[model samples]
Target chain A: MRPLFVSGLCIASALGAGLEESFAALRNGTSGLRPNDFEPFPHPTWIGRVDGLESAPVTGALARFDCRNNRLAQLALAQDGFEQAVARARERHGAARIAVLLGTTTSGILETELAYRRSAETERLLAARDYAATHGMFSLAEFVRARLGLEGPAATVSNACASSAKVFAQAARLIEAGICDAAVVGGVDSLCLTTLYGFRSLELLSAEPCRPCDERRDGLSIGEAGGFALLEKAPGAKAAAALLGYGESSDGYHMSSPHPGGAGALLAMSDALARAGVRPGEVDYVNLHGTGTPANDRAEDAAVHALFGAATPASSTKGWTGHTLGAAGIVEAAISVLCLERGFLPGTLNTGRPDPALRSRVVLESEQRPLSRVLSNSFGFGGNNCSLLFGRAG
Target chain B: MMRVFLHGVGVVGPGLENWAACREVVSGRAPWGEAALRVPVPAMLPLTERRRCNAASRLALAAAEDAIGAGDWPAVGLATVFASADGDGAVTHALCQSFAAREPEVSPTQFHNSVHNAPAGYWGIATRSARPSTSLAADQDSFAAGLFEAALQATLEPGPVLLVAFDLPLPHPLALMRPRRHGLAVALLLGREPRGGALAALALRLEPEAMASPLPPALEALGDNPTARALPLLALLARGEQGEVRLGAVGARQLVARCEQ
Candidate 1:
């Protein structure tokens, strides 16, 4: 597979907006999980909620697309001059030649949830909501493409946590097949009641900041984030990293639970390596999905151990940004890019003691190290798994 | 332009039981009639798993099963692309209603079924396939977007690709927001190379300012559903004729699909 350069990228998460903020937070070992303050139905769990979405609704011509999720996307797109980069790409490849593929589990369902609440409270007819622009799964892509003035093919992937990670793979395919000369690939997942109580319903919410791979790790700290990257067939002079490969697979076991043996996770990792023609030893780091759930962490640990054997330095950055669900893939991929450019390796935050039973060398602190290739994992509900490999552009 | 061989097809919609049963109507050889969409359990699903699947999942699985079965292809290794306009309408309605009623006790099963890829996940379990699968949405253009994605994948990969598009009506109250007149699911087994039993060879190209052909009045009611956007292409195939129809719009361009037999 030909490597697609990450010419432009930006991220907004609990860490903050833009690459600089997130980079500062990550380097300073800041944790973004805060006590549940979200209204309507605030469960007793910490979350990586993005600030300012409430005061900042998408306005103007695209006002109908306004929603917490779309707001996050808007906020992220505004950062790091990503829109400007896209404008340049639009000039390089006609707007219709750049596809937009995004991922999100719950697109603006919060708008629907709020509508339902308001309708019940007022005892009136449910006000008509712009379902397509607001709550539809395609809303994210539609909003982004419209906002960025891109006219190329656009679609939204919604396979749970693996959603965003899979977008990179699709972008690669579309570009490789010449359907699009370039692609804007990423994901945006905002804090919403659906995931809050939904995770609660599954009893997978952690009361504290999620401590991934910790011996006493309980469950995940839900987070909200949005990030994007411009993928081009060739790297620009200033390009810092390239997408070496991406692999996707399904765990045929259970909808919520991962394969106990991490069969699918291993396959995704192996496939990414095989596609990039990179040996396991060549990967400088592994970013585990590491949701902090006992089962999720253990399964990932097993898979990492099976493949890289305790040698590769790996950690979960969830402590700084919780589990961003559908956005996890791109957010982490952005983090990997930062790691490549800054010559640093981020360690698992919020974990004091790594689980002794886990075989992988789970790093506990951020360290400055020159890194080349990195593999990031994002597994989603319904047993969807994706692993992405990024490296310094040659 | 990108090309893929369509080896098999499956469809379920109002009054249409399966591809074989409705070819005459789709081909305009017979008048279409309205009937309830009866989503059958895919034979591949286990009893316990059947009970766990929601309507949308069952609809997609049923169509996928039909397509795989018709092609006589082993389901274990084929990559898949599942697309829908609205995913799991029932679950969304339930969750929203539960929260609105202040009874926010979301059933765990419903929570798991809420994911857009629930159908793909269930299909993987039923077929025990670990092959790559994606679930996507493009609003009213979901079918077209799906077809493009699947064809591109089939062209790039070595094996056959299964494309499934499905959608069901949103329950009342929520239905007021976005209403669908019917439920529909369509599947196509696409391959890079023409197979012995190939139904047709499709050449998909994106064209600017292209207008999608309107559905025949006989099949017009099915048009209310996004997945039914595949009807035009299916209708062309049903006639066993070489023809072209616009699948739907992606962005600024519409996907024009030309079929060669």
Candidate 2:
């Protein structure tokens, strides 16, 4: 299948909003993880939290849908001339011809949780509109679509960590199937008490900044991020990354852990390579599914080793961005595009020693090199995994 | 475009535990009964590990078990895809509670279970298969999105893929947003069969069809029990209901399901 070019991309994450900041952080090996400072938590854990969300005000019609998640979305959408790109899309393809698809895990429930606990004593229940806006997982997508004045198909993709990456596949299909001419796709997840405590309870939160593929890697650092990309069917577009191919799979082995040998991960990677019509040797870089968890790193290591042999140069950016959960795929996809565009591979910050199993294959520190095609992988619970291949547009 | 087929399906719900049980309910041999209140099997992870998993993981595991049991589990390079409207809300609520308490110590188990991919990770460890898996959450149309993702996986990857959709009632104050009594999980085995089974091609189309007024009672019944929609759709398919069956919001953007004869 021919690749669907990514015409424009923008991002808002803890590292700093906009493609320029994020790319600069990646190039400089900056760690976005920091000690929890927003809401008090029992243990001191690292998180990639967007600053100043509480004070960020929403104006115009978007005011009605204001929340931490929406605020993050607003910040991300403002990056990289994204607003101008959308306007151009509307002018070229009409507002009704473009669709909006967003991927998120929690949506606006973080605000809803706050509302439920902090409402004034006079308040009996949450305001109906606030409740409706923050309750559904589709709220974020709807907010983006409404704010952009887009009338085409607008839907939310929520497949855990794979949510946003899968949106690329869906948007491409919609355009190919004649559902729309162009689409805005990305993901957003904001820091909330639920996500913080939930991972803590699960024992997946790292006490320090995460060390992906490190032998001493303990677990992941939670992070919040919002990212968007303008996808179009046309192949030639300025400053765009092409969606070469994507592979998805499910190994119904367990509910929480991955297959010991990375079976599903292997399938997803091989499938992606097949779809992109590129051999494993043709790939320049790999964005790993390195959550920094012991089990995840081991499994993904085995999978990457099995397919690309011990020669592939790969690194997990989680150490820099923390695991963004549902937004991980899109965030990393944007980074991979940036890597291809900049002709360099971002270093895996905080990874001092590579896991012995991945010693030869894994790239621990950042390196600058010419690269044409890059692969990004995101695996989620229930053994769900997806791999996407991106290439420079001709 | 490849023609996707629903070769086999396995479901685990409150009243319907397996295909046989599902068949009984669909055939009216037994009452459709109340939703499966909780998971039926023992936690695959030890108590130490299990403590970290949330309700979504429990239901997802059970549903995957039923789906895998319907076919060869260890042989095929199956890609597992799980979908829900709220991914791990119970765990999310617990996390918030801990944060609100301002406690100095957080449970490691709780943190692990909080990742959206916890269930998938657990499934991978238990199965000892290294196949890839994905988890997805979309509001009302999660089931459709899961189905679409699974079909896309089946087309892209070799061998079969399992698609599981599961969601449990929200915890406490969060539940007030969309209240429901039970949790539901459904899994489908999608593959490329040589000849047998009915093939359904799913496509998203923009049509002028009016949004079905008030939504059909059967569909509305699904509000409280989102997983149940799979049963009716599967039952209809098992009975050889051919052609596209659209399942999603009605408007400028809807998920179009077209099952061809």
Candidate 3:
């Protein structure tokens, strides 16, 4: 498999809107999760939410696509000049040659929720023509495609948590298949009541800031974020960390809970390493899916320990940015690249005591280590799992 | 170039139920059937699991089972690509209604089924497949998007891949915006190597949509549903005709599947 370099990237999470801000928060052991402050939801749970989405409205011709999700995407696209980087890619690869693949679980479904409420209150449906355009599942991708003026293949992957991580694999395949030379890949999921109460209804929301790998870890702290990266064939444009390989699998066990034995997780991790032609011993760090849910943490701990043993430093960045649902993949992928560039591994931010029974080494504090290879895991509902291997570009 | 052998096909919609039954109607050999909006469940799924699956999931699973049953292919290692324009609208509407109430409360089952990949998850659970699956959306171009994704995936793996594209109507206020949706599920079993039930070879390319005659009235009516974008692709596979149809966006970049048999 050929490598795709993430030449350009930007992230807007609860940690702040820039690379330096995120790096500083990670290096300083600062957390982004806090108690329930976001309004509109009755659930009393902590969350990681970005700022300005509620007060800031997306202006310009793209105004009709305005929503919490699209606003986050627009803001992230403008940060760190990611849109400019995409503009350059448009020139290098031709506007028609660059593809846009994003991921999200609820793409402006909040707008629908709001619309339904308004209709229920007023006894009539809104006649706006762009309601479907702004609220459909593909709305975010279409908005991003138009924002970047990309004419190549564009689609949104919605496989829950594994969504964006799988986009990296798809970009490689599409490029390797001669479909496109460059792709703008990422995900955006803004905080919404649907996610808040939906997870609450499922009893998967943590009442406190998430404590990943903690002995008493309970459930996840939901979050909202938007992140994107430009992937190009290696020799054309190089970055410190490049995507070496990715492996994907489904559990065949349960819809929500992972296979207790981590069967799918092991398959995904092993597949990624095998495809990358790297031994497990060579991986310096791992970013676990570690949603803080007891079932997920234990299952992932078993999978990681089995593959890399207790050597590689591993932690869940979800403690920093609450699990962003579909956006978790890209957000964590960018963080993995940052780990290789910064030459340090991030630790679980809010965890105090790591589970003793788990054989994997769950780092509690950030460590400055010369890291080369990193593996990021994203497992979604319905047992879908993807493991991505990232490394220095030689 | 991407080439996949269409080993088997499955489809379920209004009046048309299974592959063998739907084939006759799609190829213009029989009258198109009509039934109520309720999705029918075949015996492939057990009662316990079937009861848990929503209409959208059941529709997708039924179509997938039709293909798997017809191809007689092992489902254990199959890769799945589930594409839908809109996810489970019934569940989503229920959630919205719940939220609108004085107290917002969505059922746990509804919450889990709300994820777009719920159908694919059920597919994995029912088939006991440990293989990977992707769920995606491309609006009106979902059929083409799923085909593109599936063809690319099949090119890399040795085993056959499952491509299931489905959509159900949006309820009420949401329905007014997307007024054309109907319950429809279409499945295709694609493989690079020949299998026993292999039907025809297909090569897919993205190109400008060609000016051509509109489909017959009956087939054109099927286009009201987003998943019916596969109507032309189905015609090619079912009739053993060497042809290509425009997919994806109507005027923008489109997927053209040329039957190379």
Candidate 4:
């Protein structure tokens, strides 16, 4: 895999609007987790909702595509001058030579839910005008491409949680294949009824702020977020990090549940390490895909323990962002890059006590540290697993 | 830089069941009629896994089975790419209705099967293949995207790649809003080297496509369903012709497949 340099990146998550806000929150050990305000759920659970997005309008021709998900994408793109960065990339690669790949689970499904309720009363589906276009899985990527004025190759990955992370690899392949010179790869998933209730049906939504790796952690705190990174074939002089390598594997054990032994996770981690040419001893830190679910954390611990043992500093940042579903990959990837750039090991916030049986050193406290290489893991439903390695260029 | 050979092809569309049947219809030898719009359940799936599959999953798996045939489908290291314009519309519709219910307790089965990769997951379980798989959506242009990803895997990975693109019309409320009209799926088994069951060879290059020849009405109907967007290329491959047919758009360009017998 050639070095696909990340030229610019931004995220609008529960942590806040831009890179500075998110970085500052992480640096100060602040948890973005808050009590639920999303309607129609009876159970008391924590959520990582991005605020003021309802009024975060998409202007001009892109207005018809507006939904919570696309709005979040717009918010994130506006932050950190990501939209401006894209303009420069378009100038560099020519707008037609860039690709757009995004990931999302419930993309604009909320609009459909609203439409469904209206149609159920009217007995007509025409009320949901753009439902046919936006509700489909590819809507976000199409909307983002239009918003950024990119005409290159485009697609949306919706492999549950690993969606966005896998886009990085996809972008790398297309560029390496010479199909494109640069790409905007990321994911967006906004809050919707399907996920809030769906996770509850699976009994996987924590009632409290998610405490990843905590012994008493019950389930994940769902979050909505959008994020992006501009990956170019050549690194700009100011480029801080590059997508070193990525490993993908499937559990094949269960559709919803992970492999109890973390077999797939281990395979992905090893493959990513081998691909990145980084050794276990060299990884400065690992951002675990700790959803705070008992089975997920324990299984991931087994895999992490097998690779890095109890030595490498590791933590699950889900505590801050909740589990952003499809956006988890890019959000955490951005955070991992931030960790490499900012020089710190982010602690597993809100955890009272780390799991006693885990062998890996779970970072329960924020600490300053020099870092070179970091591995961020994202595991999704259907046992889809992806491990991404990020590092500073030599 | 590399010429990828197509080992096997599978297809399930309105009136055709597999590549052999699809070839007959696309070659103008058989009457191309309106689709029954009914996708048969994939017999390759185990009984336990059957209940977990929806129309889209069945459509995808059935096409994958046709492409795989009696040859070996390695249970390991086979990367799968599943693409769809509309993913699990049935589940989306059901989930939406559930939200309307007084007590919205989504069935665990529906919830798990709702992922866009549901068919891909079932593919892993049915074949006992724990290899990596990705599910992507490109709306109307999914076939081109799926082919691009599959070809990339074929060139990069050591193992053979399976590419399945499928989609199905949603039940009312949603379908009335955005009607797909037909349920369809197609598959291609690709590898760097042709194996025993190899069908035809092809060199796929990516470039901007000028509107070449207009599609015949029968084939034009195929375009309405995203998976069926591969019909033009499929016609060329099935004819065993050594000519080029545009595989539609990818990035800023289209996939120009030069098929060879």
The 10-residue segment with the lowest total lDDT in model 3 chain A: A120-129
Residue pairs in candidate 3 whose N, alpha carbon or C atoms collide under 3 angstroms: B15-B33, B15-B34
User: RMSD (Cα, Å) of candidate 2?
Assistant: 4.5
* Candidate 3: C-alpha RMSD after superposition: 1.8
Cα lDDT of model 2 by residue, B67-158, tens digit? 66635445235667777767666766665554444352456655556665666666765665556565655566667667766776676556
Taking the tens digit of each residue's C-alpha lDDT, what string does model 3 give over A26-107? 9988889888888666667898989888888888988888888999998888887788888888888887778889999999
Q: State the lDDT at A274 in candidate 1.
A: 89
How many clashing residue pairs appear in each of the predictions shown?
Answer: 0, 75, 2, 2
Q: How would you encode candidate 4's per-residue C-alpha lDDT over A224-274 as one tens digit per residue?
A: 999999999885447888888999999987888898889999999998889
lDDT of 2 by residue, A51-146 (tens): 888888667766877878888899888889887888888888888778788888777767655654553521345435464456577778778887
Using lDDT as the measure, name the better of candidate 3 and candidate 4. Answer: 4
**What's the best-to-worst order under lDDT?**
1, 4, 3, 2
Best by TM-score: 1
Model 2, position A110: C-alpha lDDT score: 70
CAPRI quality level assigned to candidate 4 from its DockQ score: medium
Consecutive 10-residue window with the lowest summed lDDT within model 1 chain A: A119-128
Q: Between prediction 2 and prediction 3, which has the larger lDDT?
A: 3
Per-model DockQ: 0.75, 0.32, 0.66, 0.68
